[model samples]
Target: MQKLKIAIITLITLLSAKTSLAQQYMKFSWKDLNIDYSAFAYLIDSENVIVRINSTQSGVLKLAEAAGKLRVHPGYSSKARVLEIGIGEVIYSKDNKMSGSFPAFRLFQENYDPVTNKVSGRSYVAQATKIAQKGYLSSRPDVKVQVYNKLSDVQQNVNAAAYFLKEEAYYKQFAKPSSPATNNNTSTNNNSGNKPAASQAATPVTVHLVLVGDTKDASIGESVKSDLIKMRSLFQNTMSVNKNIKFNIKEISGDQLISTNVENTVKSLTVGSNDAIILYYSGHGSNPKGSNSDFPTAAMIKSSYKLENMGNLVSNRNPRLAIVIGDLCNSVPRTRTALPDQPLMRSAPAQHDPARVAQLLIKAKGKIVSTSSSYDEYSYSLGNNGAFTNSFVDALTSAINSHSNMSATWDAVLKQSYKEAYNKTRDIVNKTGTKGQNGFYRGSVAYN
Candidate 1:
């Protein structure tokens, strides 16, 4: 009888432990509930639903309804408490196209407001494995509320879903058409290459871009290449919109990444007062024992070069705007292994306003310096891309697509990018038990 009593007590303890774990996993702050749902077509048919949930308990249902993709049915218990919310069906577009889908989800509340008829808590998701299996819809209704298991699993599902949704939206909106050769030749000859005399006479503004990457390292070579490609694409798309502005890009990698070659390339560049110069470096870096500056020293295969010196080289040219970026470690020199590749989502292409692009890129005047990691921190990379570089590209793309041109300043974009990189690094550390990296930036390019 004693043994039986002990066994029952043990089972009850285990169940209690599990319930506590689930409760902890479901706790989310108000900021966590801010999800962008403008990509869907349901809110008002023609108008996009860009909803920001102000109240924790009352907004979950509104979000589901506005998304137009989730069919949620709420159930109440004897005391008028929500027992579970059933996801009845996954609704697609009218043409039966797979526009979007919802995973099995639930909202937890701590207190109920009698006057407002609202609860006070946050929405949460179940285990990633279960959510993945039942996230999409079938022809039949899968009406069930899943229970939360682990916080890590919940985060994994949320990040994965958000990444894929952004990618899908980007591809649908901005992907280039199939035929590039014919269209490129026509556009080049008629639109850009052969411009009218009056159009060419405008104060010619050229953006000089210098990209240096350490492609010799086995672990981060691919990442350097990926950053270079994304950087080129961003500048090409944004700068090409203005006929008065021209782009000049220089790439130095492999054997050409030596200090001498890098210095000579910077010195040889001819920049005008109306022009902008940007230099981006990606590779291994280190902070020496007694260095004065917090920025990392770029470790090339043959020699090391201080980023401050490089920034000075660019700033001395006296361009309208000078920006320098180093996507590497700012800690002691050490070897690193590549992490598993995460899903990469590019910014959606939008019709950019010429004035906005010019306001941030051309009209802005000053020097900006940014680094992937702060002093004593180790920067991280996933497969073929640096985390900070990817975040900067994402932020820059968003800035270009901003509703107001005046609001899209270089300082705002860089600051947001650094914050995002820090958050991403934190998430990676949480999952892999690795050291965290914090990005840093100083100076700004202000609007004229």
Candidate 2:
């Protein structure tokens, strides 16, 4: 009798665990220009959710009745509370009146049916996963309410079906412990923090310098190869002074020849650890269109910027300083459609990308981001190379008329460089035509 009783208890415990695991929960979806909670709800409802439009006064009351009848187990209703939304909040009710009472019960913890429309059940799971991956859960419990509500409407029977779906996605991306694959890849990234004893013994702070120029479209056009020379020569001079510090000057390779090489160049420079990096780019540039909707508006480079592969380089976490000199024409813009929040524009090819430069700057810790234009300005080339490049050379050679800390020295030089580049580009464009003038922009930003 005792053995039989123990067996029964174990069976019951196992069954309870299974039941708990199967419970359903709400899945949160962010509002985009294309879709939101209403659409998400339709997708969660077993893909058979019917579109219910509240066009008449009677229809809303019917919705209230339907909503009120739902029960997780017994009399519990799954309606949402009347809470303040951004800007303002509207009280949802079965009756359209300012004072008269009507059915206003909230949905079950897992139900989030909108008052106006019911969504079909195809887009909800996808939206929920997206919101969770962005790391916003700690701040928004309402998202939890909204998600589980959708699950109850799905008829999944489990209270946590939607929540599990989102959890599965998050675990896939971040669950793995550190492994050999991650380590080997780290080595290839040349991002090692360890330095030779000699290197460590030298400078208190080292600057990572990334110098790129001669963009694919305007590579001195082959005609100037022999007759012309780099106007600014100090790019190599200043960094050579410190043997302890290293500079990874990127070489043009294969397809990278056509795009912004900042990503690869930084990868080479950041190998091991240092103090700071001075990143500079010169070549052709153009504006990326801003998005008309929620989707990112991409930057359309005259040449490719290879923004996507930049992930490896932008992951740096060390304290560093950066000096970005963009000598290419049309490198800056007025506004962008793609905000940093959305990573949608990563699809564009290398030559026309806008996010590469901005993304890299964002990842560098203790950094500053300088550009070559006002929101409406353009940058331009000087004599042989671009004006920004010439100024960079002059600054390093004289250390901006000082031998003190490299940071202050570089800052002074960049200021002068921006002024010179702006004036020179503008004058040249004025003489050429308005079309040329539109392409002339300048900026000197210090990143630390």
Candidate 3:
């Protein structure tokens, strides 16, 4: 318990005492539209608005699903594909309507024709409505989310063109700095007397979010994007009570996540004694030649950032503490039962070697590193989130809020995350197997 308490406090106390901004919100716009509605499809509008949340921070887009009810789709990021979120009626009303009076909104994947493999008949509004009335809606949804592999189903009810245009225009205007981005929310310290009593030095806690989103790679999907947003939200909620830490976050994302850019970004930053660094990567994780192999080398991955190289970069920085997590397929398969429902639209489970996994862990040894998949089992992602990373974010946020004192340590946090990722990826394989929820059906009678 003492070790755990120190570990938690060490992480929190390392931040600089001064105030700084977090990369909290990203103004989103439609970047791609691949909704699976076939050549001939019905275009209808059910319920939507330009977008507004009375308060600045609204995290209400975290509930209701029908790709089989109450499912959670982690964050997603793509260069070509973009999905914007809508504000539910729950945000507008203050009557606590959600408890009973006001029903919950449902989100089901649009259905496809069993024979043609094209989305047949369905309105986005109707699908969402059904989930509100019929699906297993949660008063407090805690189910492990199984990411829908087919993204077109996730945005089943959206109007591609119109939505893209509206959000793009809106983001262009909103992201622009208003009045030189000035803020009047600072309070004066008023230490006018003698020398201010030699105050304690503010520790510098730099959180670098090095994310890679290969939207062009269909395999990558939206998980990367969602991981970025959710990670920030998790930290925000967890650190809300601790005012002593000053946070500085730098995002090396999109095309900039290449090796050169990543290296340069690290070089440009400075870390003082007792300072800490938090590193997160969610793109593609590969091992020796992208195939089954013997023990892996330090930097075997061929994506934006190499595994070993990333570890070394942080070590050179010499931060008092660091956590580097990689959510990708190292695919070292130990024998596990095959995923269910393959005859339908499911992909086979990946085989990974445990020895290879150990090699990858070697590079991350000093930095509390974690991989999404073990030996050769391919990891999964959904929406704008990497499946493992989403679970990771959830575990951290939940751990922080678990005890009022924030007493949980790095081990506890990592344990919660790894367990969740294992279960989530396995469930996705099973549920998405033969006879899946790829189509939609509305009964003659309403759900309620």
Best by the TM-score measure: 1
Write down the TM-score of every candidate: 0.55, 0.35, 0.46
Candidate 2 lDDT, tens digit per residue, 6-40? 00000000112112322233333333233233211
Q: Candidate 3, residues 40-84: lDDT per residue as tens digits? A: 111111111012222111322211111111111223211111112
Question: How many clashes does the backbone of model 2 have?
Answer: 59
Cα-lDDT of candidate 3: 0.36
* C-alpha lDDT (0 to 100) for residue 75 of candidate 2: 30
lDDT of 1 by residue, 191-246 (tens): 35343343343487888999899866777875676667557656864445555678
For candidate 2, report its TM-score. 0.35
Off by over 4 Å in 1: 1-201, 345-348, 402-406, 428-435
The most accurate candidate by lDDT is 1
* Higher-scoring candidate on TM-score, 1 or 2: 1
State the TM-score for model 3: 0.46
lDDT against the true structure, per candidate, is 0.55, 0.30, 0.36
Q: Which stretches in model 2 have alpha-carbon errors above 4 Å?
A: 1-207, 215-235, 253-255, 258-265, 268-270, 288-303, 306-319, 331-365, 400-410, 428-448
| Per-candidate RMSD, Å | 19.8, 24.8, 19.3
Q: Which stretches of candidate 3 lie over 4 Å from their true place?
A: 1-83, 86-209, 236-240, 289-304, 332-366, 402-407, 427-448
